[model samples]
Target chain A: MNEYLENAKAQMRKGVLEYCILSVLSEGDAYVSDIIRRLKEAQMIVVEGTLYPLLMRQKNAGWLAYRWEESTQGPPRKYYAITDAGRQLLAELDTAWQDLGDSVIKIRQPEKTHSHEKRI
Target chain B: MKNVFNICINGIIFGIEEDAFKPLSDYLEPLKAYFSREKDGSEIVADIEARIAELFTERPGGAATAITIADVNAIISTLGTPAAIAGVDESANTEAQPCAPRRTARRLFRNPAERYISGVCGGIATWFGMSPAILRIALIVATFFIHWLPILYLVLWAVIPLAKTTAQKLEMYGKEVNITNIEQSVKDNSLDTGSPVQTFFRDVDSALGRFCRILLRIVVLVIGLKLIVAGLMLLVAFIVWTCLQDVLFRDVVKWDFLAYEEMLRHIISASSYQIFMICSVVFILLTVAACLFWGAQLIRPFKTGNRMTHILLAALWAGSAMGIVGISLREMRHFTNPNSMSETFTVPVTDTLHLQTVSANMKLSNNAVTGLYFDKSQQRFFGEPTLNICHSRNGQALLEIRRRALGRSKPDAFDKLAGIGYQVAINDTLLQLPDLFSVSPPDRWSFQEVHLFLYLPENTIVAMDEGVMAHMHSNAHSRTGQQEYLWRVTDKGPRKIK
Candidate 1:
């Protein structure tokens, strides 16, 4: 029973990985390690392997561009930056997420209509 | 001691223990399999590899060190299995439909734990739900008829990644890679649940592997040592030859160059031959040393100045080859338009003629004695003309002395050929000839040598000393005896005189 639930949770997390990556990159160009740190801070991504495929797909689709930057330690790192296409897609996703959040809030807390909770 | 394998990941070099490399490879293989059908699969894999390399860098003093199983396992857990990530693609492919939970595909991994000789047959047997013994028997039988089967098996063993983890062991048997299967496989393998025959074969396999490794190491060491010794000898010989080329070829080495002293002088003056010799020797020595070093590296691989040395040696070799070819082309000009000059002398029609060599103690200069010594050494480097006995055209005994040489043109060849000095003294019935012919320096070697033809009339009898046999052509069947013997010319040919 626990296995099924854990599997479901992982599946749910996999769906949102691409959106989260795009969102992280939307703020500014970031090194892969920096992006990984941001994702870990949000507790949205676990293994770094899972995000690689998503980042590669985004880059291949011309939604992202990357450049090599010299690192203080070790070799140079590849920094990925969001392209215009990526920003356009992020805007659409943001609108859809807002609508979905509103609908879910209305359905779950019908009694407290129009009430907003401050969450961290 | 644990052996470490050097690997390049994302263009960065890393050393990892042999035991840990298997599990790490196993962890990466599934990720590759998951993205294989994707449009940007290889790029995704490359990114993943880079990320792994980055993670290794973050490890405590682990940047260039050997990565252990613990490190690999931690990374694998953090990355999550490919099965965990399959949902997104599956859901997208199904067109917004609820994604069905898919069973993880079973992977064929070589079972090293129970392996006898690479464990390929064992892993395959487990995959097919068959006994490993049966597969081993079948393979052995097939190997007898199909000569290449053993080689193919070795190639497969090398290519297939071994199943080191419980998850991998479960996958090897086509079992689900869930927790229960992993737990069961671990328990089953740890506890001796396998048959006695399997255990025996496993032990034998491991023992054989150790033996093979030791044997291979000895073979490589012996071959490496031999190469080093051979290379050192070649280098020493080259040094000695270079230092003593002139002395060795001139005095110590009694080589008769047909006594063309002028030709020898010309050859020595030309610097190209010397350059050709030195360059060739250097090239050969360096190549030998390179081969020895390569053998040593093969025996025990380690980082060295491999590329720079290779380039340097290759360039030197090429330069030497060009020098040899260019110098040889120039040398070839000295050997054209071969010509011969003949001088005929009349002799009295004696009933019996005796041909003999001058005594070793006869009146001769010091140079002549050394020339005789060189001839006696049997190290003649130039061609000597044949002495022929033929019937005279004018029914008289005539001695024809001919000297042959090669030069740039007809006049030059004739002049060089005429320069060859030889003397023949006729005393009564005896004709005496010098054993060693002389040639002076300032002239390049021109294959100069004299040919003596004793033109005897129909009834004239001839006797030749044993020394004359050295100059006689092989086809001239001169009847030779313990002492000088006479031969009478008959209708058939020269017949031994009673």
Candidate 2:
């Protein structure tokens, strides 16, 4: 049961981590702060450190884009949002997620032959 | 408005505002317009946004309270494209978009952090993906202990800005697009309400404060380190000195205890005693000097501390050393002069004339022995001698003072009065003084060679003896010399007063 639970959590992570990040940005052209707060609220376990490195990796992989804005307090601020590539990849991930979910549900489902045996 | 949707994305739950939802639905209309033939664009946009709001509100911290555009994106992502959701794969349709820097999207980051003075050192190290060690070591070594380094840190802390706005700090990490922290992106790090002059003054004030703190910290650290090193060295020095105590002080005093006393006895002298006494005093003086030097080590780097405290400690050390020397000198005296009374030099040759001379008429300071006594008169074959003298034990020689006439007419009553009149007084013997009193030259009859004929008993002990040969030679010599000065000893011996 523990092994099955572990696999379930792993499958959830691969499908959800990127969607979760993009979901935060769909609010607006949000900065890193907005994303972390949203993720932290959802118990996403995303840290500022972990998030930035991942963001940088994704940006390199062409799933992200950014722009600069002048700020009064410090030097300048950068805001980020998903591009078409991010949207497309998120779509592909959604289908893959449904398929994985069905497969896992079928495995955990009670056997049809055992259903009649239990009813007696 | 009949349907209210709550969106929870990544567990962040917030309600989808109808006003915010309307704009997002309007923006996705263009994308849905491409699939208009296959799916109802308005219906698809509405259904996706409702699901997005539901998920936003489903998040843990009431994400339903405020809905951002990012919420709509998550729902769209879940549903896929209009073509994909309407039962068509998006394999070929999504290919035309190439990832590029977004000119339309604004980036948010933490202000160039200045809240922490040296945080620049820390922040830059973090931002550039560099280790703090490399920066810190290079700075310290390069600055040669810069007096202004701390000030620089303070100024940096006050002026550069802080990462209070989540957007600015993220900018330091160079991430802008797809940032989820829009609400945290509020508030520009620069003071929004203050005037230009006020901001300038604030910067200057913080800069000065930072400078002072850095300087003070460095100075305190340096001084503390110096004190610690000096204390360690002094501890080692003290240990070494204590170990060498026996060797250092063993031979400081040098005198044959018995020989000194024997010389003083037979010669009726105090010169040897003085020499021995001085040796002991010198020994004590050296020990005190050594101890003082050792004590100074207790307060190593004493020169750097408070002047008044240094002076006070120095005075205390000096006083203690002085006391030690004084006590030691006093104790040393006992080794030279001990107490015992038996061997007295008994004067017996009463029928014959016996005279003595003290080489140096040093004062007979020892009070143990009193004046010398001789009662019976001697029948001198020559002219009757007038003055009687003796040497005292404390080194001073004395003579019985007498009245005399310089000249007189032949055997007259006036001569009798001037010469021997009623001036003579009597005691157990003539009242005597130290032998130095007879340094006067006789007018015509010169003193001849000394005859050592005085018989003193063997068992007798005397502190001064000048009754025989020494007495005669000194008298003859005095009678012959230029009368300006007196008793001059030819050998290694003591001399006397004029």
List chain B TM-scores, each candidate: 0.51, 0.20
lDDT of 1 by residue, B341-440 (tens): 7889878888888888754442321233223223324322223345777766577788898888787788988877766656789887788876655443
For model 1, what is the C-alpha lDDT against the true structure? 0.69
Q: Against the true structure, what is every candidate's RMSD?
A: 10.7, 30.4
C-alpha lDDT (0 to 100) for residue A24 of candidate 1: 92
Query: Against the true two-chain complex, what DockQ does each candidate achieve?
Result: 0.34, 0.01
Lowest summed-lDDT stretch of 10 residues in model 1 chain B? Answer: B364-373
Residue B110 in candidate 2, Cα distance off native in Å:
39
lDDT, model 1, position B144:
92
Q: Chain A TM-score for each candidate, in the given order? A: 0.84, 0.71
State the C-alpha lDDT per candidate: 0.69, 0.42
Off by over 4 Å in 2: A1-15, A111-120, B1-498
Q: Pick the candidate with the highest TM-score.
A: 1
